[model samples]
Structure formats: structure tokens, C-alpha cells
Target chain A: EDQVTQSPEALRLQEGESSSLNCSYTVSGLRGLFWYRQDPGKGPEFLFTLYSAGEEKEKERLKATLTKKESFLHITAPKPEDSATYLCAVQGMGKTSYDKVIFGPGTSLSVIP
Target chain B: GAGVSQSPSNKVTEKGKDVELRCDPISGHTALYWYRQSLGQGLEFLIYFQGNSAPDKSGLPSDRFSAERTGGSVSTLTIQRTQQEDSAVYLCASSQRGVRGSNQPQHFGDGTRLSIL
Candidate 1:
């Protein structure tokens, strides 16, 4: 079965403290790996989509990197506004006509000033 | 709409009552998806609509859950005989299309929070 797991279920960091959130996955024929940020009472906001190993994408203080087995979301100098649940999803080729995305239990990050 | 839109921002109803949630996909988007998120959990896929047809419904938890899309633009999810366990945030998302191996990331809407009392 295709599955996704994220580490450090919850993390509290001081402002300007850099850290990384891990997302590990096992899937059949990985097609794309996605990163999203979801705040309370709001749907997830798209971040980066990594298609292959060694691929990396950046936006502001966030960076996403992918490998064959896992993906990492590195947050640098995070601010209180950056606190949210970071979600990781994997889209894989499957027998169904449409591809299915498996999402990991998100990492809740809190940045305190 | 400029982005994917969902109706009934919040719903509170007695158990066993049916509820209908609506979604309006972005213009020109040919793919729509419905997912349910429980407290502190990841999205649980419910259905996927490619154009006006749903090609995948296996993710639905039970027969009480059903959904449909009309005119390839609007969709509805109907939950029958709702139970307390059905309480969750229902999310709608859309992509350019449901092509294989495409890089289109789904755009999401602020979801509808359903509370079955």
C-alpha cells in the first residue's frame, strides 16, 4: 500500500531558529511530491511540487527537497506568521484511471518570537 | 470564480439528518476533488471528478457518502444519515485536468466545517 509518514508530529521553535520537517513515503511509481501549508480553519495552500530526486524548490523562508524515499521541508528563520501545519503528499501512478494522492499526517510547527 | 469555492462555511445539524455541500471549481478546470479532514489528520480522499464523471469513488468511506458534478463546473457532496463520526471539514479542490503524469497541482478552497450533533 502507498503510505506517507511525517516526523516530529509537533515542533516549537523560537523565531529565527531554522529546522527541518521530514516526510517519508513508500509508493508505486512516484509521479510527484507536493508540499502545502494549512492554517486552522483553512484549506491547504499549495507550496512546491517535487517531481524527481535531487529536485528542490523555494519560496520565501521555506525550501522543499526530495529524494527517492523521502522529502524534507526546511524552514529557515521562521516567523510567528509562518506557524501552520505543513502537509506532504505523494501522487503516484496507480491502476485507477486517475492518479491518487496520499498525504502524510502533517507536522504542526509553531514559531515563537 | 477566481478560485475554487465551497458553500456552507459551517453546518451544525442533528444526527441522522442529511447535508449537502457544494463546490464551484475554477473556470476551465476539468478536474474536481472532494476530501474530508478530521481533527489533526491529513486529507482523506472521498471522490475525484474528471470533467463530469467520477472515475474514482473507492475512497468514500461508506455508501452513505455520494457526490456528483454538473455542467463540469459545479459539484455537490451529499451525506445521508449523518453520524457523529461524520463530523469533519469537507474540502474541495481543482486542477487543470486529470491527465496522467501531469504537473498540475490542485488549488483548494476554504472548506466547509460539518458538525453532526
Candidate 2:
């Protein structure tokens, strides 16, 4: 079974603090790794997509890096507005020739101003 | 719509009732997806539709769950005999296409929060 695991279930950071969230996965064939930010009662917003190991993508204060077995979402100088649940998902090539994505339990990030 | 749009922002009903949630993907998106987000749980993939290809329903938890995408634009997810465990935020997402290596990011909507009584 393809599985994704995220570490540090919850994080509280002071404004401008920097940290990284982790997402580990096991899949047959990796197609893509996605990062999203979801606010309470709202749907997730797409952030980045990492396709291969040693690949990295960034958007404003967020940076996403991927390895063969895991991915990291690094938040740099985060602000209150950046407080949200960060989600990690991996799309893999299935045995049936179809593609399915498996998600990790998100890391709730709270940036206290 | 400019982005993915889902109907019925919130719904509350008895356990035995049936419900239908709808989603309208972006104007030209060729791939649509449905997922369930339970409290404290990660997003669970439920179904996926890509262009005219057959939908992959392998992620659906049970036979009571079904979905359809018509005209390659709008999609609907139906649940029969809704159980208390079914109460969660039903999310819909869309992308430019659904092929491997396309690298299209899925855009989501403010999901429909379902509450079972």
C-alpha cells in the first residue's frame, strides 16, 4: 500500500520563525509530490509539485524539497497569515496503470504574532 | 468558474438519508477529483475522472459511494444511506489534465461540510 506520513503533528512558532515540516512516503512509482495549505473550514490551496528527487520549488515564504523517500516543506520567516494546516500528498503510478494520490496527516502550523 | 466550485457549503441530515454533492471544475480542466477530509484526518482520495477515460473509483470506501462527471465539466458525488462516519468535508479538485508527468496542480474549492445526525 502506498502510504504517506507527516511529522510534528502540531507546531507553534513565533512570527518570523523558520522551520521545516516533514512528509515520508512509500510508493511503487512516484509521479509527483504536492504541497498544500488549508485553512479551517476551507479547502486546500496548491503550493508546489516536486516530481523527482533533488528537486525543489518555492513560493514566497515556503520552499518544498523532495527526496526518494521523503519530502520537506520549509517555512521561512513565517507570519500569522501563514498559519494553516500544511498538507503533503504523493501521486503514484498504480499497478492497474492508473494514478492515485495518497495524503499525509497534515502538520498544523500556527504562527503567533 | 475561475476556480473549482463546490455546492452546498454545509449540510446536516439524518443518518439514513442520501446526499449528493456537486463540483464544477475550472473552465478547461480535464481532470476532476473527489476527496473526503475527516476531522484530524488527512484528505482521503475517493474518486478521480480524467477527460473521457473511465473514472478510478478504487479509493472509494464502500459501494454506497458513487460519482459521475458529465460533459467533462461538472461532477457529482452521491452517498446512499449516509452513516455517521460519513460526516466530513467533501472536497473537489481539478487540474489541467490527469496524465503522468503533466505536473498539473489540483485546485480546490471550499468544500461541502456534511454533518450526519
Model 1 ranges off by over 4 Å: B98-100
Q: Please, what are the lDDT tens digits per residue for candidate 2 over residues B3-115?
A: 78999999999999999999999999888889999998899899988889999898899999999999999999999999999999999999875455553888999999999
- Candidate 1 structure, TM-score to reference: 0.96
- Backbone clashes in candidate 1 total 0
Model 2 chain B weakest lDDT span, ten residues long: B96-105
Model 1 residue A43 CA deviation (Å) reads 0.6
> lDDT tens digits, residues B1-117, model 1?
598899999999999999999999889988788999999888998888876554589899999999989888899999999999999999999987435545488899999999999
Best by DockQ: 2
**Cα lDDT computed for each candidate against the true fold:** 0.90, 0.91
Worst 10 residues of 1 chain B by lDDT: B95-104
TM value for model 2:
0.95
lDDT of 2 by residue, A19-46 (tens): 9999999988898899989999889998
